[model samples]
Target: MYAYGIDLGTTYSCMARADQDGNIEIIKNIEGKNITPSVVEFISPTEIVVGETAKGDAILAPDNVVLYIKRSMGKQDENREHHGQTFTPEQISAFILKKLISDAEQMTGEKVSDVVITVPAYFGFDERQATENAGKIAGLNVLGIVNEPTAAAIAYGAQQKSKEDKVVLVYDLGGGTFDVTVAEIVGDKVTVVSTEGNHTLGGKDWDAELMSYFVAQFCEKTGVTADEIYEDGDVLNELILKTEDAKKELTSKNSSSFTLSMGRGKRAKLEVTVEKFDEITRHHLMSTLELTKIALKQAATKTSSKGKSCDQFDEIIFVGGSTRMRQVKEAMKKEFGVDPQVFEPDEAVARGAALLAHFLSTDQPQQTTGLGEGQSAADERFSEVTSKSYGVEAQIGNSMMLSHVILKNDAIPCSNTETYGTLAHNQRRVNIVVYESNIMEENTELSFGKRIADGQLDLPAGLPARSPIDVTFSLDRNGMLNITAVERFNGSKCNIIVKTEGLSESEVMTLQAQTSVIKVSDGA
Candidate 1:
């Protein structure tokens, strides 16, 4: 009967839930930790290990470990083949979810079924659908999928005693992605103004920079060629593991060092200072700053009629475990005059999601202990905006172009219908290709954006060219997409629920059966 919130992160995952008294608590894994490493190791054909234990075995069996799988969520061709069985990103992610749910059920003694998961605000429809599919494959009823930055804001807003309105900027830099969002909080409601991010950018890039530096230094000192080390998976993975540790040490101290044992009883000792670390990774930090600037400008335009400057943000908050780096904090302070506040850098998203899950599960309006009366947790409203522009490919005059149906930053639960004509005389069918783009311009060349979904709409035989066809794009509250094509002449229609890039229906069901029988165990 309890609903839980899960932050299925790129490098780590955490789950939490609101108790009967409305107190949010992070559910710890069997290893007695609030967070579990997002690592999975296939020990046998039917056995898999998740979390810290799996992460530890990564150095020993690099080929068997799956790391940073989040980056491949929506990629159709990205998969792993083990022991004559193929596994997609969604299936691999399901194992992680199953591991977390199994541990959570044991700790709370509650049957965990309905739950809300969090994703990056800038995730496209394909990625979002893939995440939901993963949850389904794990045998959990997914109540909803909340955005990471918005979830963090909800958790922060609930903790505030003030009723005054504030404009908050959330900078989320996680292990595999970064999102910068601007939101307006009024009373208990959190309304997102604008969000911008790169799903491929995050703390792992920082780790890569450090790892490259270590490899170079080691090669120079030990006379070990970079190619020789790179070709050796075990050695490369061991160095990568050490590089991550060194990065953590530099976070709290001025300097840190590690020694790598080269073959033939030779060891290369390396040292990295915090200053040197920052110097090497300055570009990555600047990339985030630039995205923040874009988000701020968009927010200012949306919130003000008089064209106010982007500095109108009342406060800035940092989320995501990667934000724990000292360099990130220092850069924020130097760029923006206001000091950035850290709100539960590791657990805020899951905590906020837990609050939402509780509200969604309750049938009647219930009051939380912290918020004042008349503020029912169930009644709190959340408004989200679209992260990317959605369009369909069309033939305009002589050249093909993308006709936009939904612009980026448009409010949720929005829909748009555009009419187009067939390209050839007596065309038997119309090709409908949906594309999504981060670019703001509309009616641009098809190359500017990537196609997400495509389908063929069969038209009545002998349909003349220039026949009108209505294409409608509808976005639900959670940003899932639905498309409908109608023939104005005959009223015939085609409904397509933009397919997920991860897997087909039959594929998911097959994987679900396979995952159900597999034994997913904790690394501990």
Candidate 2:
């Protein structure tokens, strides 16, 4: 009866196990490392290598090696071909997960079956489900998919022995995605207040940004033009990785050195400064602020209606490796009007998920965020999950009522019912298209598809708001949507399913056989 927690991240992956004592310790890889780089390389079309081995083949087998596949998971067109075999992003990622699972089992000396994996808060249905399929391919039963930000909040809040309920914003700019989550921590319970991000933005973007700088430096020293150097894809790839290393090193040092062995030119020193780096990354950092403003306004209204002042959240806690940048911290401070608090950026989410793993496996659930075992008492910070919501309660029509389903800052997954009234006399046929709207001051904007900030599709129609129609939007633990509309007359109903995003049927089935999986003895 053992449980495992895996943080399947864009740049790296880590695993941990919950022992009989309810303790969670990370399982180090063969290199005696707790974090294994999420990289995979194809050997002979059928064979795959991961982590150090994969990195070893990067220079030699550049075309065959794939790194940061997790970033490509939630993408619209993730179909990649290697050696004439079509591999969806999910299948490639599953290979990385499989490698981690096999290595962890060796370290734990036991059969591992159940797992709790981490995902970005901004990951839509397709990406989250895709990660789950990857886990299935590795043969581990996923207990839950926890948001990476919320998990980091839990781990960070536990590390801070504070009893005060505060709003901590997690700025997670990983290898492929950027997610900003504001969480409220009270006692041991940590709840995600609001979240926003773009899946396309991440550290990889920074790598490209630095590559441009590298090109400038190389051209300045060697008198080589972009057309001459970048014409070769291999040279561009080589410079991109070199610049990525320089960017990471500039975290502490003012400048870093890079050597190029191209037949065209001599090596040059790229004098990198924090100010210059921020100058390049300013726009990207500012974008997160816009998202934070939206999240804050929602959180503000949520706290206001609940009678909790937004001022209570004095310290803005951060959890993400990308928060290491000084510019991001400044951006957060300028946006939220508070000093950003960053603790345990890399391991916090996984650590929190591991704690949750123990709670799910065994009953000894310890409240790490000042929230003890049971439900919560009466406080502005949302009390036990009675009825929860994220969006504001507003009128859809003159007489009809509708609830915009959104999670509150302090509230967990709760639904608020909107009562609708009859538009006309004897109106039988009706159309109910669920629209997600973001409110700013008195302005309310409709969200549809990717057009708006976060838009949704049309829900089934019940009887026209004849007699108070009640539409309940339920958000399950998986961040998915469910709608139930009952007509005021005889409770006539309409139900529909939103298309969930993930790996296709054939891709998942094909991957099920390739990975080595450990099957647990059910009797024990």
The lDDT per prediction is 0.87, 0.64
User: For model 1, what is the error of residue 16's alpha carbon versus the real structure, in angstroms, after optimal superposition?
Assistant: 0.8
Residue pairs that clash (backbone atoms under 3 angstroms), model 1: none
Steric clash count of candidate 1:
0
Instruction: Score every model by TM-score.
Output: 0.93, 0.79
Which digits, one per residue and each the tens of the lDDT, describe model 1 over residues 279-320?
Answer: 999999999999999998787677532244434877899999
Stretches > 4 Å off in candidate 1: 19-22, 304-311, 365-379, 422-428, 458-467
User: Lowest summed lDDT over 10 consecutive residues: which window, candidate 2?
Assistant: 378-387
Best by TM-score: 1
Judge candidate 2 against the unseen true structure and give its global Cα lDDT, from 0 to 1.
0.64
List candidate 2 stretches off by more than 4 Å: 19-22, 162-166, 265-269, 302-308, 330-341, 363-410, 416-447, 450-471, 485-493, 499-507, 514-524
